[model samples]
Target: MKLVKSQPWRNPDTVLAQLIQSCARTRNLDRGKQLHAHLVASGATPSTFVANHLISMYAKCGDLYHAIALFDRMPQRNLVTWTAMISSFSQNNKFGDALRTFSSMCAAGIKPTQFALSSAIQASAFFASLEFGKQMHCLSVKLGYDVELFVGSNLADMYSKCGSLVDACRVFDEMPDKDEVAWTAMIDGYTKNGSFEEAIVAFRDMLRGGTVVIDQHLLCSVLSACGGLKAGKLGRCLHSCVVKLGLESDTFIGNALVNMYAKAGDMESASSVVGMNSHGWNVVSCSSLIDGYVEMDQIEEASRAYISSRRQGIEPNEFTFSSMIKACASQAALEQGIQLHAQVMKTSFVRDLFVSSTLIDMYGKCGLLNSSIQVFDEIQHPSDISWNSIVGVFAQHGRGKEAVRALNRMISRGNKPNHITFVSLLMACSHAGLVEEGLEYFYSMNKTCDIEPREEHYACVIDMLGRAGRLEEAREFIAGMPFEPNAYGWCSLLGACRTHGEKELGELAAEKLMKLEPENSGIHILLSSIYASMGQWEDVKAVRKLMRDSRVKKLPGFSWVDVNNKTHMFGAEDWSHPQKEEIYEKLEELMVKIRKAGYVPFTGSMPCNLEESLKERLLHHHSERIAVAFALISMPATKPIIVKKNLRVCVDCHSAIKLISKVEGREIIVRDNARFHHFADGMCSCGDYW
Candidate 1:
């Protein structure tokens, strides 16, 4: 420093003191070296204070090699010197070195300071080693540093990071003086562990205590909790607090606000927050908006926002590309996704695990399974998520045996199969009607893989058994479940019963479903359809009465198809299209051709108790049928038609589409609420398994 150089009249100790302080503050390594030379020339005994400051300066500057060299050459050392070196390694992302240095300090018989203890505990968290963290806790207690505030806060954080939330809470509870940093750490720990409600509660307690200063970091943690819990009212309250506290101008706080509203499903508020803020869009803001749109199923809006953001000069990161590509998958816009894929390949982000996995999902959802496999093959050291994505795509495409082979391969490659992997495998077997195979996999989950079957796995097993006309065994399996079956398990059984014409068991499963989810209109509708299929008109009327009494309404079925880069949506009996007349005419002609090709009007799946003529007429107006009719009129017959539905395809429409696909000599791909169905030459990919 010039201040040190100009002080020639000052004593050597005073000059060295000033220089060390200046170097530590600014992390000026060159000046620190010059000062060290001056210290040597002065011939003064090198004080531990001066050495510690020099080491801290080097460590803070990320020159760990210099810091370690200085430490090793020190004639004497103190707690500050050891702590400075450990923190240097910790801050530079060399967590293993930090831990080893702490060990060396202990072996050197130097008692640790509170700062050293905190840095060592934090390094354990960064390492994500529970054993090391517990050892640190034991050491903290042994050395009488466990009760210190800084050490306590770090212990809480370390436990949470190691997935020991209970111990974290215990540490927080045992703390005597919880300052702002301590409280913030606890709240963040709760949020990190998915204890959103507890995080909010802690925030409320912190506010009521009024002893700590609430800063931007604290506000961001609470906002994240609100978002995770979907507590819109609380989130709005936090928004007000941000305004009152004058934090609205902060870009990071603004990003948190956007995330809170987006995760709360209030995208209108989220977009308005983004628009009103003067802060320009960054990667986080753009990614938040795109991800929110995808979560809301607003694929078109996500596309527009992505394009607009790129025009505004904000480069998309891996998260942004992943969200946008998933939106393309949802829209089944294969061409748009391909263009995005090209952009990704041009950049280094194509190698990112999330982006690559999303590419596979996009191709699979768009019915480009070959392209999906190609992407899978190109990935280097694919994570379990990548493997699961490819396996899921195969399952969705109705390739059960191949999916099983992939699962085995994943295991052989040393990637232990998680619960999600088995879920994919069981789903594949269900889609392919492999009842026995599904059963074996379900059992193997616990016996071989040591993975417990969650409710979804049981649902798959039920669906598999029900698909094969083994409704009785499916019921027995549910009764024998280790835990109470969730609503999905019962709903799957009901759907299977409806498919297999097991009216009695179907009624039982529907009753169970209604009791578990009385407000679910789909369950009531399924029950009504089951009764109608059995020619029980009175039961259908009773179910309808029950629905009316409960005031539960079914979601109106709608189907969407993309053509020429534009998406068009159609609902049952829809007449809002400008080409309605032409669409209706095409539908009539197609009906005639399919009828001539031995396609009978099937109304057994319709829930309404009406005359045969009216039922058949109503079936013709189903949303998917209308969407297909419109597609046939709007596009060439040689190109395949892909339609996405909001609910399961009715049996009548499915059968009708199969015949139409054969008669029109066109391939028709339909994605219902559950899986994809590709119909060609009067055959469906599901092979009537569903």
Candidate 2:
């Protein structure tokens, strides 16, 4: 705004208006205020046109207070004046005020311009006010602005944000000319509303139309849909498109690409995207990588990513901490989880609902139920997720009664138990052998809670009955299921049959499992174990031969213990550890002591037809035993020995651990694939049920 220093301007008001527009464009609030003062001091009443620009300048400068004051003082306001004020409120996130102003404009018989209607529609979208949005749509139609590209695009956006995709699509289709913004709104709406398939279809249609130029925003929305569907092939195709479009350098596009690749389980591609991104990793990209690694059960990689992000000065937000904690939970890495918990406490996310719930779960899975309870108790206002996590903690620890009490408490706090709540509840009952209570809860899922029982709920019931040794009832329940029983149901029955030494039924369950999952090594292993328990060497040989013929390799069972912030893993009879001599010596010493305490090695299911001494030797050297031995040698006696296994603890090892705990006078907690076993005072927490 160069001043007219040479002579007085003939059209001073016009020059002032132009200067005010310049100030608004630059967001120069100080200059805008100076011009306002000049207008007041010149003793000339500015016309409505000039006044409108002043209002716009103030609004654009973010001085809403002055904008509103100026608006209130303006005795004559036209469409531009009202539009500027309404847009100001909308832009500043004063959504309710924007809508109110829109209403007042309507009451004043002021027909809104496209800009005003778009701002009001955006406000409605932010509020998710479908009814108000519909009214706005109607007004746009009545004012013959519905077909206007700007207003129609906003209408579609509002509908989508309100979760009314049908209406959004209708508006989008009725538009005379759909631009990139309109198509982007519809696609984004579908993606946001969980209609991933529909979103993809719309994106395809937009591309097929070929009239609208695709932009980064449109690509980002479609990529999100691909991620949701885990459509890796399509995601790769989009990656190629991004490269060709030269949008790969864009920060937002880079973040979206990382998220898509991560969600699609292509961590290699995801990591490359992060590396290739010119802007480098931010919290969003780093968190997505961590989450992807966790989902793939690569806890070590996830932890490394977390550490690398921190080293690069990227702070972990709630999602990052949550994913890392979840990774620790998956591996039962209690020490690492504890370290993450401390880190979370240092950040403001310690009290975040998702992070807190993840912390509770990590503690519970690591066999620290007390820590989980403490975390839950610290939550100021527990959400359903947090409540469910606490209940799940009790369930994981086999505390059925406490889980029920937690559920009651959750309900009392006005939080409804969702489907996840009942899953944990049913699991608790199953682990505790509360058969009747488990059945009651399973039935109550649909009757009382309005949550239709999913397949997982039915599987829990079967598991409950199977764990109670009610094989006949469990079979009947499966037979009576409305839908075909899934693999979990059959697996539960087979496990129970193996536990109770029911050879014929175990064989039958194995047959069903073979048809359902022909390559499942666990089924073959379980069946072979059942045959071995019955001393049927020929049948065991047959199963082993079938595994070899099908090329189905059994996953080797291993146990790992964290000592001094490092993990030591062991397999059955493993001699791979650097301290194998010490571990074995300690294990042999403990075995001798446990045997003195009347611990007899139970090798009924040792598959190999070997001498009694060799079988007993094999049983004594199971992976969990080796892990516990290592923990006892390396960890302090005051600390409980926590060993995590990839498979269920064998009955022989379970018995030996009970006696070892008593003889050594040290608590040993073994977390296997199924559940936790707290061995102390010559007893197990499962009471020998597991």
Candidate 3:
């Protein structure tokens, strides 16, 4: 601009021309107007090409009105002028204006070029105007732009993106020489349109033609297709190819690599890949990692990964926060999760809906039901996510009555319940021992709401009946289900037999449970306990031998208690604590008080061959009771004692704890594997059924 401004003999017309070229390139509209004024003062009328450049520049700068005005003022227009305007509209996402401009250009008898055709076709795709796209295809053929490489590619891309695979393929086949981009577009279109078989065929065809055998983008897309089509073997083959091709360094490919392993049920390998690429922990990558950890129930590892992300200064986004919060709830990391909630507020995600939902779940799992309710209140207009999170919290924590109340309110507010919503409701009812309400919701799931019950929903119903002591009804429900019962299904019935001491049904259930889960020692222990409770020592010994033969190991029991905002965990009779001597002294005092209130040892479920005195040793030293002792000693005299157990508590502990809660005049809430047991006033929430 300064060069044009300083030279007087450079000629005003030539100088103004050079300045307009610079302004158009830089999109300096102010300088462009100054250049135009210089040209008009020199009595020079701008040419068609100059006017087109001005229009293109203004349109590129998002000044659509100025571009259209300049084009209308042009004394003569060419294909270049029309294409420049249409391309600007398409790029700005004003697809409707682009199409109308094309129509007007044609009405004025101006022929369009390959550039015009591509821009118009792409605009059709932007708007999903499939009919208009077809019209553009016809116009391109008549205008002799169909043979151009870019024109044909745009046509295929438009049809493919518009979800018309047939038209996209027709355009692809008509092309003279299809490039790699065309092939990739066609393959993606095939997959997006559910023609996965055709997609695989296209990939193979590209390979046979000596095209690039493997690239990061292509492999990532094809691996995702394998997951969608459930072709695990093919996905593994792709993984081998990716490794051999040395494209594993690509972050997108690496994330897909982890996801492919997890989806194929090879979580051990998935973690290996995730471990090698710590920097690959973006929102998508971390989400896949957390999901895999959750799938394998690797509770602690999930929390560690979340902590690692925070330490790396890669502030967790919504997906990372949502998935990590879910893992925290699963692992019962309630206290640590509270800090994450505060961090979420300081970050840019304070108003995020998914983040709010995850917080609801976190507080809910920790038995902070009121906190969960408060988070729900903050949601401006709660959607399914907010409803499901709060409802699932109650359901998982055994607050069945409250969960139903919330569901009714959600429906009243015109929020529809999804399959997961009903699953949580049934879980709540199962834990609450509400047999009639559980069955009613289960029946109405598919009939009224049109949400078909999955295996999990059916499992909840079986577990629901079992919790209510309707063992025969549970058996009947399994028999009447549309699909064959799964391990969870059989496990539900087996749990009932163990609690009710139904020898005939217990024996039948053990047989099925063994067949379904031959390697689950918990099921073997469950079977043995039922036999021992009924005084069938021979059957108990036989069940023990079966477990020994199978070589299945059970997870050790653990318990957690919160006191003065500090969580204390005890595993078994762990006696190495710094305050072990004082803890036992408090335990002894609690034991004597409960014993005077008619408490007796019920150790029929113990598997060890112990003397009469030793049986009571294992019963009283149970982890839940030990954690309760710690809670009672540390908290105020009448403060509610909250204990969380890793597994379902034995019947003896359940009854003894109820007496302890009454004697101490404290409300003790114990969350076990199945449901919460609120022991107050000498009553268990499960009514002794669990």
- Find the number of clashing residue pairs for candidate 2: 0
Q: Which lDDT tens digits does candidate 2 get at residues 451-503? A: 99988889889889888889888878988989966788778888888888888
Q: Cα lDDT of all candidates, in order?
A: 0.86, 0.89, 0.79
Ordered by TM-score, highest first, the candidates read 2, 1, 3
Q: Tens digits of per-residue lDDT for model 1 on 227-303? A: 89988889999999899999998998989998989899898888888887668377787788889999999877887
Best by lDDT: 2
List residue ranges in candidate 1 displaced over 4 A: 1-11, 23-51, 61-79, 100-112, 204-210, 481-485, 515-521, 542-556, 571-598, 607-621, 629-640, 659-667, 680-689
Badly placed stretches (over 4 Å) of model 3 are 1-216, 223-312, 409-414, 560-569, 593-600, 608-613, 635-646, 657-688
Models ranked on lDDT: 2, 1, 3
lDDT for position 214 in model 3? 60
Per-residue lDDT of 155 in model 1: 94
